[model samples]
Target chain A: EAGVVQSPRYKIIEKKQPVAFWCNPISGHNTLYWYLQNLGQGPELLIRYENEEAVDDSQLPKDRFSAERLKGVDSTLKIQPAELGDSAVYLCASSRTGIKEQFFGPGTRLTVL
Target chain B: AQSVTQLDSHVSVSEGTPVLLRCNYSSSYSPSLFWYVQHPNKGLQLLLKYTSAATLVKGINGFEAEFKKSETSFHLTKPSAHMSDAAEYFCVVSPSSGNTGKLIFGQGTTLQVKP
Candidate 1:
């Protein structure tokens, strides 16, 4: 089975510009998650979606970040007026319902300069 | 709330030697623990997981981990090191309560294998 898939493996944008990343979870999976990984650190959760409902998004920077998993299949994460600190790798993952083990995508490396 | 700590930032092992990466976790209740490996420029891959089952869990690529409740530790180990085993390893924990599936990850341990 194909693992999670993400688009624009690498992105470069100027500070204050808006940037977006896309993710497509594995087939038959009902739980999806977004994570951010800074250099030399482990990934930090951003948001989680159970089907189309965002069950947990406490870590998301609401002022500048927004995410949606419409139709319960694909998802998108957007950042407006990106700042230099926003430069990091964005990872997407998915798993079967009630399963904690996740399959991750290659990730989108965003560079805000 | 749950958290994980990788005791070592980096470890070096000679090819054919044993490998060990230490991890400790804090949780209010029984937790699901996992080991994930990430090769440079690649995404995280599951090495193995312990979910209140066997304390000794064997994973892919000849890696394994032992979950010790008394010590609150889950340390990854490999019988013998291989050059290809050089990568960053992360320890993770998730609540075993309602099965939310939200994970807390450790900083990470970088393994270096010498020829």
Candidate 2:
């Protein structure tokens, strides 16, 4: 089975520019997640999607970051007016259900210059 | 609130030597635990998991982690280290509270293997 798929494996943007990351999860998966990982650190959950509904997104930065899982199969995470501190790896993961194991994508490495 | 802690930020060992990565967790009631490995420039892979099923859980690539409830610890260990074992290891926790789905990750521990 194919693992989670993400586009634009690497991205470079200016401090005030807008950046978006895309994710396509495995088939029949009902749960999708977005996570941020800084250098030398583990991934921290940013948002979670159960079908087309966002059940948990308290960790997401409401001020500058926004995410959506349209149709419940794919997702997009966007950061507007990016900051240098936003430089990190953004990982997308999915699972068959809320209780199953998650499979992660290769992650998009965002470098805010 | 639940959290996980990886005791070591970095661990160095010689090839063919034993490898150990310490992890401890704090959770209310029963919890599900996991160990994942991430190679450089790669994504995370499930190593093993403890869901109150087995105290001693074996995982892919000859990796294993023991869940100690009394000590609230789950440490990853391997009999012998290989060069390929050099990577980042993360201890993960999932609360058993209802159907609320989330995985809390500990600060990753980098593993370095020397010949």
Candidate 3:
């Protein structure tokens, strides 16, 4: 089975510009998650989706960050007018419901200048 | 609240020598723990997990971890280190009582294997 897939392995943009990252979870996986990883730190959960419903998004920055999982298979995370502090690796992961193990994608490394 | 802490930010080991990565966890209830390895420009890979099973859990690529409840520790160990073992490793914890399967990760430990 193919693992989780993410587009644009790396991205560079100036501050105050809008950026978006895409992710396709593994087949038959019902749980999808988005995480942010700063340099030298482990990934932190930003949002979680369960088949089109965002069940957990307490960590997401609602002011500028937005995410959507339309069909429950693919997800898009968007950052509007991003700040320099927004520069980090955005990771997408998926797993079966109630399963503890999560499969991660290659991640989109965003560099904001 | 559940959290994990890696004792070392970086560890260097010579090839063919033993490898040890220490991790400590804090949780209110029984916790599910995991070790994941991430190569440069690569996604994280699961190394091993402990879920109230046997104290010693073996995983892929000749790695293992012992879960000590008394110590609140789950340390990864390798009998022999290989050049390919150089990577960043994370210790993670999951709340046993939650159905969301959310994971809390440590800062991470970078392993440097010297040949």
Task: Report the lDDT tens digits of candidate 3 across residue range A18-95.
Answer: 999999999999999999999999999999999999999999999999999998999999999899999999999999
Best by TM-score: 3
Docking class of 1: high
Which RMSD values do the candidates have, in order?
Answer: 0.7, 0.8, 0.5
Error of 2 at A108 (Å): 0.5
TM-score of chain A of 1: 0.99
lDDT of 3 by residue, B49-90 (tens): 999999999999999999999999999999999999999999
Clashes of each: 0, 0, 0
Report the poorest 10 consecutive residues by lDDT, candidate 2 chain B.
B94-103
Q: What is the lDDT of residue B89 in candidate 1?
A: 97
Higher-scoring candidate on DockQ, 1 or 2: 1
lDDT string, candidate 1, B1-115, tens digits: 7999999999999999999999999999999999999998898999999999899999999999999999999999999999999999999999999978898999999999999
lDDT of 2 at B35: 96
Name the regions of candidate 1 deviating beyond 4 angstroms: none
| Model 1 alpha-carbon miss at residue B33, Å | 0.4
**How big is the RMSD of model 1?**
0.7
lDDT, residue B28, candidate 2 = 88
